[model samples]
Target: MKYQYEFFLPQNPKPIDTITGDIYDCEKKADEIVAELGINEDDDLIIAVTEVGNND
Candidate 1:
């Protein structure tokens, strides 16, 4: 058996526009990092989800 873990941005941060319910990217900036960079900006913010394998 093995366990998995992931590191993401925000780290439980607050939202930017409560009315719009905006979300921010944990890894990189929205304007800075674009689809060309292999990351898409969903809504007005960006987000990234990654996992690590348990090398035991």
Candidate 2:
């Protein structure tokens, strides 16, 4: 079972905006992205993890 991480920008009073459709292999890589993007603690950013290559 493989997994991937994704990041999104939160839309005010609505859906989250996709920052990158690219999937990260590890959580560290995803965290790096947040740092690289200079996302602040007060910033509306969302981090998610999903299963990859899984049909079931």
Candidate 3:
């Protein structure tokens, strides 16, 4: 699986490409990053999504 995240600011015109997940995980990694950035749901929205890919 491939995992990544997008962070959006209400006042910004485009989304910010935040950190990418490691080979094994996504959600916990995102939580850690959001804490580091010090922003919560009211300040912005962080979305984590995953897509499955071929083993090759």
Candidate 4:
């Protein structure tokens, strides 16, 4: 499944960055991506489910 992963900082109303892809590409990759950029435990990761391509 595909998803939109958003990385947000504490007290922020919007995400700093967004990544769209499958679990491995979006979720896992986002983890590694943010770990290097610097963040604290107060930060949040919001996952939004999305469908890519056509079902029919």
Candidate 5:
């Protein structure tokens, strides 16, 4: 199994364009984005994790 991380802005119900437009392999990479973009809690950004590939 594998996982991918993505960041979304303003909430999850919106279209993907609302995303931060980046994909990360791990939480640490995502955290780097938070620092780089100066994202705060008030920023309404979301870090979503999704499963990828197949275990088989």
Candidate 6:
């Protein structure tokens, strides 16, 4: 018997990664800046945050 196997499936909405940095109140700041600068598709802003290691 012959059969086809596909492990990976295509996602309807592709995921994207946004660069972020260390900061407090990230959500509030992201929103504030988005509005203040009138950001659009033509612009990109990097968010900041702290990173924790698995050993920690």
TM-score of each: 0.19, 0.42, 0.42, 0.53, 0.49, 0.37
| Residues 1-56, model 4: lDDT tens digits | 55566666657777777777766777565666568765443355544455664323
Q: Write the per-residue lDDT of candidate 5 for residues 1-56, one digit (tens) a residue.
A: 56555567675564232222224345556566667767773465575666665546
Q: Can you rank all candidates by TM-score, best first? A: 4, 5, 2, 3, 6, 1
The regions of model 1 sitting more than 4 angstroms off are 1-28, 35-38, 43-56
- C-alpha lDDT score of every prediction, in listed order: 0.35, 0.53, 0.58, 0.61, 0.54, 0.38
lDDT of 6 at 45: 51
For residue 45, give model 2's deviation from the true position in Å. Answer: 2.7
TM-score of 4: 0.53
Worst 10 residues of 5 by lDDT: 15-24
Candidate 6 lDDT by residue in tens digits, 1-56: 22221111124132222323333344555565567766642245543234533322
Candidate 5 — which pairs collide? Answer: none
TM-score-superior candidate, 1 or 6:
6
In candidate 1, what are the lDDT values of residues 1-56, reduced to their tens digit?
A: 22221222344454332211123333333445444445345643524333334435
True-structure RMSD, every candidate: 11.9, 5.5, 3.7, 3.4, 5.4, 15.4
Instruction: Give the Å shift of residue 49 in candidate 5.
Output: 2.2
Please list all clashing residue pairs in model 3, or write none if there are none: none
Candidate 6 positional error at 20, Å: 13
- Report the Cα lDDT for residue 37, model 5: 68
Once superposed on the true structure, which residue ranges of model 6 sit more than 4 Å away at CA? 1-24, 41-43, 51-56
lDDT of 1 at 43: 40
Could you tell me how far off, in angstroms, the CA of residue 35 lies in candidate 3 after the best superposition? 1.3
How many clashing residue pairs are found in candidate 6? 7
Residues 1-56 of candidate 3 have per-residue lDDT tens digits of 44455656567766665555554455565466578777775456646455545445
Which candidate leads in lDDT? 4
